[model samples]
Target: MAWTWTLETAAGDVIRRSEDFESRGDAESWIGEAFGDLVTDGVDQARLFEGENEIYGPMSLHADE
Candidate 1:
């Protein structure tokens, strides 16, 4: 199964989805590089998935505020 990521707003609305990644590490790295911009764009949460199965998150990108 391919790994992918969903970036979301604080309200739990999906803002963007990543293209399929070759590995979980690659997906995670993409998120790390993109996280700052995502937060600046109002994405307060991020979710990871392996195909249809959610691996984790709605993890916070914003600092506690």
Candidate 2:
């Protein structure tokens, strides 16, 4: 189970999406923080989606040596 954040422009023409979390709470929190700034300007709305396998983990990790 994971969470996804989606942001659509005011015109609903452009869309931005991000997903890389294991907790829905974390995802929504991030979305709120990010969208809060955009909304102050022109962003119309923001949405959060939660479901199983919405995102995959083991996300590329690299050691800097």
Candidate 3:
């Protein structure tokens, strides 16, 4: 199984995915570094998944700027 990240808008529409990762930690790490830029680019939240199973998130990445 692999993990992935999804970036979504405030309206809950998905914008992108991190493709796949062999480890959840790697997926989380990628998102950690990416969320800031994603927010700036108009993404409002993030979600994590393991295969087809939702693991966590839709957590806010939005920041006042």
Output the number of the TM-score-best candidate.
1
**Best-to-worst ranking by lDDT:** 1, 3, 2
Predicted candidate 3 versus true structure: per-residue lDDT over 1-65, tens digit per residue = 99988888888899988779999989888888887788788888878999989998878885552
User: TM-score of each candidate?
Assistant: 0.87, 0.51, 0.86
Clashing pairs in 2: none
lDDT of 2 by residue, 1-65 (tens): 56775555644543565666677778767755665565655455545556634333222111231
- lDDT score, candidate 1: 0.89
Against the true structure, candidate 3 has what lDDT?
A: 0.84
CA lDDT, candidate 1, residue 56: 99
Clashes of each: 0, 0, 0
> Best to worst by TM-score, what's the order?
1, 3, 2
As a whole number from 0 to 100, the lDDT of residue 64 in candidate 3 is: 57
- Which of the predicted structures, 1 or 3, would earn the higher lDDT when compared with the native? 1
* Cα deviation of 17, candidate 2, in Å: 0.5
State the displacement of the C-alpha of residue 46, model 3, in Å, after optimal TM-score superposition: 0.9
